[model samples]
Target: MTRAFLRPDDARDLVAEQFGADRRLTALDRLAGGSKKGVYRLRLDDETTAILYVWATGENYWPPSPTVPDDPFTDASGAELFATNHAALAAAGVRIPRLLMLDRDNRHLDADVALVEDVGAVTLERLMEHDPAAAATPLSMLGDALRRMHTTLSPKYGKLAAITRGEAPQTRRTEDVIVDRALGHLDAAATRDARLANAHDRIAGHVRLLRSTVTARETYGLVHGELGPDHILVTPAGEPVVIDFEGLAYFDVEWEHAWLRMRFGDAYPVLRPVDLDPHRLELYRYAQVLSLIEGPLRIADTDFPGRQWMLDLAEWNITKALAVV
Candidate 1:
């Protein structure tokens, strides 16, 4: 279930200006899903639709309520990213809100908001939860979605080649940044960038392991960055829809497939007998887990612990890589 910050009435008031007095929000209910964007069931007349409220902030919610910025509450600023992504994905055969109205520039809003069609479908996660044996169905569907998205390149998406087959920006390691900031509190022996001093070397070795396994013939064009049960939604009829494009970047398109492989484990055959380099994939996912731990580390006001956790995951990825590579 997704946590919503806006009360139905408040959301209605904020959006009432868009739909017009005639199209009153006959009903508004919070739909369960999305940790990033605010989703709801909106009704007016005979139409039962979904509306996504985009907040400008990267917090992935429309600013329905106020929480401290550092506290991970709604940020009205990040809406631009969604607007860009939504439009891009929509052009690529993905279904998003109908976009009746949007603060596309959203430069002034505390949270960016957009009215879109709420596709009625159960998330892939729910389907798997209900019927674990059907996991492969969703993965293949996701692959199909990615195929549509990755088939062509667009500047609106920027260069994904930096990270993979396409041009995506290379982001700094969140853990590394955290470590540097928290070093003063850790051992006087530690410097800023509180990451283990040897981590870079280990990652380099792991990168080698990843590169070594690539069979030269394998080429990927883009990366979903984050793809899994939580981000994938399956409609009641077993339609898998990909959501959340904020994490998207150009990289090995196979990584999205890898993402499903990692999360679904043996239940999926998409990457069975996976051939990715063990060290590379391990390092990649280790870096990933570190990214996931950001919320916790920031909350706890700690860095070293999360870095160590990343290393543990890196180790596991190394082992998992051995099986696939």
Candidate 2:
């Protein structure tokens, strides 16, 4: 059975411990777009607010074990992922919401929780829709910040937590991992859609063919695996701060740009890296679409709050996937 979200009273002591006894939680509202973890906005009596992240089984919408346990892209959630990636991003000079408190011991909440500065409700996606001209500066800033992150190299390619703890799996070619994930997504997508099932062989062949064209590369850079405009928070001062860093890893910059291109659409040109391998971009783009198709369909199977939206996303991407092959 699904559990209920935390209530204001439930987190009052937690807020008091970190913030102060004088600051009381007046309201606790669960924000939208948090599928992996619970994101709540806590309003205090002092007219201030903070964001809370709860990493618990109840909060996650995706399957408990969606993919191979060791896969770098497998279920990038949890306090450790957030904390490790947060530290890595800060050290790399990337701007993220300031962390106020982290509860790994589950002292107050039954789950691992983190409290961070609330950067307001406006996301870069919403800002672009409402005021394109006003969004230009923050978008540019986001581009520059992303470029910096994409160029920050790591000795090995893996999740930041694993890399930092020196427990990263044996190094493999970036292309190999990409192809494997894409193929895996394709296999899963095939079972649900008749069109994908019919074209499964053709699509799989195309993916492998694309993989063969890529050359070997030694350098890998830090990348946010799930960077979308919705994940970027625009401050009142018009500065852009990126959120959702749990999927942080060292990977091919082309892979990152491919996702950027898909999510940003025409605006992607503003954030595009000048030196991306076209071959890698093509392969990754197709793979990313396949993932978009598979992941949403997987999530839609559950009683997620966004079930219809997830199904719609899968439907749209299935069309995109068919056009590719």
Candidate 3:
């Protein structure tokens, strides 16, 4: 029950034990691009490499209000949830890193950690920035992979718990969850800037309309809540593999589509086509903007850099979302 963060020696010891007494951990390098978790690239004496992901505690993770008493929307710790999600997605034939071992009980490490096979690939975000046209084939492949993943259906929609438990986590309707999150984020944004109050009211007025759009959907599917380019990696063989399952949930497919469209625009080719409702997508896009703002606003008091840039981007997106709504 150590309260201290896991150090390099701790990780090396765990990796050595998992591999063998003879096989030593040669190097442990912390990887970037994770906000809520710590990822390390580990190299062994045998020349094999792997990734170690340490899940964030509730205190460090975002979307939990520190000021509000009895905040019901806090995200549960992702340690066990990430392990469960990896198992479920791998079983469904999704292209994810091979999970070697999981430490959920915090016995081997201070926090939950997972040792996974490193694909030794570059992230799609870097590739896209270097050459968008050259990255087309891989992007299309990712679209196909996502289409396959969407086939994973669930009985109810909400958080990752619903997907793991195979039932709704609570009695509240999915529409209520969506609306409440939107309102919560909007309120948070308004607290930082009074100008956002009007935006909040405008979006609030359209809650019923937005709810109707979500309710009209006949089925719920597994959603990679944050499927941006950074989470996707392209292998040397030109295959795309997905990573980061902490945000996985059961929700309307349009929310996933909207995320891609907002991030990649028309350049991202949606291979497996669906009848997209533009109005609904726009509403969700607004919700997405609000969600993006929520995290930065919630942590504004801290010394986190790039907070202003995020708020600026959120404001810009809000303007775009408002134009359509």
Candidate 4:
């Protein structure tokens, strides 16, 4: 009876323009697990489907933070960023959903919307849940896709949208960014939870201690800033198509692997992350843990329906942070 985001009819004109005037939108179901944007599956009269991404203010549940949007690690949203990363990845031979339409001019909807080919409901996460053995092939395929993405090098380390548009390159070293961002998260989390506050200095020292062991690099690789089984979709034929390219950027591959290790857990080794820098991985792993803490807590502060899940995530990561000290 009530609607927080765009209704099915709200997107009627937009869908019609994309699929032609004859194709009618039968339904638009908002999928779960999106905190920064509204992800909807649009079913058509012809029994076809497409995914619509709407960057509306009502859709984002992340509470405002000190970090600016330009930061490589900040909230990755907006249609321009999506278009830029999509083009970069698609050009790099990554198998992602085909972009059907992009309405940046707001010709159809008041918000910036993009319509992409529907890869289906079988996420790599879902497939693995049904049968871990069957996920082996998809995991291996994901490893290959990640390799291709990581091999796509960039001279500058930052969001593809910023660097490619002639903006000044991110001059600071990757390690510097990691340390600063982690400290920022530490400070934020401390304000909310007394446990993090008590262990702040100790955990901060641990982060810096790990950072001290890292060396600088001359180049960076393209990475799906957040790569997890959930971010990947498996086609019926067993092909892996990665989604959520908004955070796609050229950065330390270890940063990507740290996230991969966390999300993939025991299934991580299947990706075969070889020749990685241990020092970078360790430091990034700690930083990533802090991020998981702050991110969930921030989202939970809003009207997110998964408030309990977010708090639990922050609590779990809090234990993780305190344990290492």
Assess every candidate by TM-score: 0.60, 0.97, 0.86, 0.96
State, as a TM-score between 0 and 1, how close model 2 is to the true structure: 0.97
Report the candidate with higher lDDT, 3 versus 4.
4
Query: Model-by-model lDDT, in order?
Result: 0.49, 0.87, 0.70, 0.88
Which lDDT value does model 2 have at 38?
95
Q: What is the lDDT of candidate 4?
A: 0.88
lDDT of 1: 0.49
Error of 1 at 298 (Å): 2.6
Clashes in candidate 2: how many?
A: 0
Better of 1 and 4 by lDDT: 4
lDDT of residue 288 for candidate 2: 90
Alpha carbon lDDT of residue 92, candidate 1? 73
Pull out the clashing pairs in model 4.
none
Candidate 3's displacement at residue 125, Å, is 1.5
**On a 0 to 100 scale, what is the lDDT of residue 56 in model 3?**
51
Better of 2 and 4 by TM-score: 2
Query: Which stretches of candidate 3 lie above 4 Å from their native place?
Result: 1-6, 56-63, 66-77, 163-173, 212-215, 305-309, 321-325
Best by TM-score: 2
Model 2, CA-based lDDT: 0.87
Error of model 3, residue 172, in angstroms: 4.9
Candidate 1 weakest lDDT stretch, 10 residues: 65-74
Clashing pairs in 3: none
